[model samples]
Target chain A: MENLLGIAIGAILINNIVLTKFLGLCPFFGVSTRLKNATTMGLAVTFVMTASSILTWLVYEYLLVPLHIQYMRIVVFILVIASFVQLTEMFIKASSPTLHRSLGIYLPLITTNCAILGVTLMNTVVEGYSLIAATVNGVATGVGFILALVLMAGLRERLELADPPQAFQGLPLAFISAALLALAFQGFSGMIL
Target chain B: MKFQEFTKGIIKNNAVFALALGLCPTLAITTSVENALGMSLAFAFVLISSNLIISALKRFIPQEVRIPCFIVIIASLVTAIDLFIHGYSPTLYEHLGIFLPLIVVNCIILGRAEAFASKHSVSDTFLDAAGVSVGFALAIISVSAIRELLGSGTIVIFGHEVVPAFTSSPAVVMLLPPGAFLTIGILLALLKRAKVI
Candidate 1:
């Protein structure tokens, strides 16, 4: 239980998927243009990250490791993520069209988001997390990603209103803002589990 | 044909600055010049080989199943690279670790395979892949140089000290994750100010 809490906190704050680990950055900048879209993308990612981590963990421990073909993880993991996205699309279309439309294109983009793959890989390879531990870490990391995205979206909205020099207008300015935010988050690095 | 392939990737359609693909390594590995060079070479090996094979076998692969096909070929190449790196350069292999295999999912390789290689000739595809890889290497290495010097107060490459240490305790954040973000963020702004990117 203590280990579980530590992993969750560490994943969310100490080793944040976006701000700290540098995982899932594409969506951090891409989908963060609007608050609503950011929330929807966050929820969608949370769902996928949790599901895929569990799936990958079970496969790695039972199937890949036992078979002595750990090299196949990249192939297997990608195939699983691609197919899982397709499956989620079908399920959402059938079960919740409104939610599906809300998510729209971001749902497909989730397939490429490195956070999901990063968590799964970190769970199996880096931390040697068990199936349950991987699931917890996965969900926590997703929540962390969502937190970073929301924070970034809020700041970006404000930046759009603020005056800036010509050179820092678009992506460049966005990056500068991220730099400041990252500096602030560095304070959390010293937190004790 | 030669210039078309080379120029497309270097500037106009440069993978990092222009295309904005593959930001993970662009941020993570750029913390050190050594890691940056290692990653770029690793990525180049995977990208060029995958492009050639995928381009050569373009006809046999079905459109409906093309993504999966490209992934398998790319994954095999990544696995091969992963093993070779582990065997030859254990230190680099340790530093690169997950990022190495994660190359299989890097949108750049699959993006090029789907967008360029699937339709272009094998030779042109090779050039395109090489150009993009070099362009990416340039970006990563440059960022790493700035971060290593600033974040660590010294620049060391492959266990050889290139410069004397200026301070005992460097900022150290530059070696951390957020520092990666901050460094790239500022660097991008500087480039924009110079109108280079």
Candidate 2:
């Protein structure tokens, strides 16, 4: 239990997907302009990451390991993520048209989000976590991603009012803000657990 | 006409600076010039091969499953390069870590396939790939050069000290995550100021 808590805290605070690992940066900068969109995108990515992590864990443990074709994980894992995103898109379209409409292109874009694939692949291949651990880690990573996105969105929202130079108006300033946030997160790296 | 397609990717539609498509590898593995060079080679290999194959097969591929098809091809190419690096250069393989496989999701490759290669001729696609790859290489190499030189007080390329230590103690923070962002941030601002981007 203590180990699980450590993993959760470590993933959320220390090894944040966006602020630290630099994964899923497309949406990090693109959709994070608005708080609502950032939250929605965050939740959507969390769902995909968690779902794909569980499914990939099963595939890696049962099928790939048994077949000795573990090297094919890159191809297999991406296909799984793409299909999963497609399925989720269709389900949302049928059940909650409003949610689907709100998501817009970002829903489909989730298929290409490296953070989803990163978490899935990291859980199975790099860390070799157990099923429970992988699921927990996936959720924690998503939470970390959400935390970073929401914070960035809030910052960017206010940045709209601030006047700066022409060159650093948009993305350049956003990146500098992210740099500060990343520096602050660096302090968390020393925390024990 | 041919040269136009090639040159555009290098400057007009640079995968890193102008497009910002593949930041994962750009920021993750650029701690040193050696890693940057190794990554650029592997990225170029995958990008060029995948673009050529996808462009050649664009018409035959069904419209409904085009994304998945493109992904499979890219993934296979990434795996091939990944394995080749592991076998031939163990040190680079270790340095790249997961960012290598993560290249499968690098938007640049898939973005090129979908945006340009899927519609263009094979020759055109080849030039586009080469141009984009070179552009990406230049961007990452420059970023890595700045980071490695200032952060570590030296620049080491493939085991040789290209730039000797400038200071006894460097600003080690420049080698961390913030430094990557800071470098790119300032670089982007400078490019914007000069209208280079």
Give the best candidate by TM-score: 2
Candidate 1 structure quality by residue, lDDT tens digits, A1-193 = 4399988998888888888787887888888878888988999999999999989898889999999988788888877887898899999899999988887688778877888887888888888987778889989999998898899899988889988887778777777677777777788888887
- For model 1, residues B1-197, the per-residue Cα lDDT tens digits are 67778767876676777666888888887778999989999999999999999999999999998987998898889889999999999999998867888887788988999999999999999989999998888888888988899898989998898877899999888887767776776767777777776
Instruction: Give model 1's TM-score for chain A to 2 decimal places.
Output: 0.97
Instruction: Write down the C-alpha DockQ for each prediction.
Output: 0.68, 0.87
Local distance difference test, each candidate: 0.85, 0.92
- Give the lowest summed-lDDT range of ten residues in model 1 chain B: B11-20
Whole-model alpha-carbon lDDT for candidate 2? 0.92
Error of 2 at B61 (Å): 0.4
TM-score of each: 0.96, 0.98
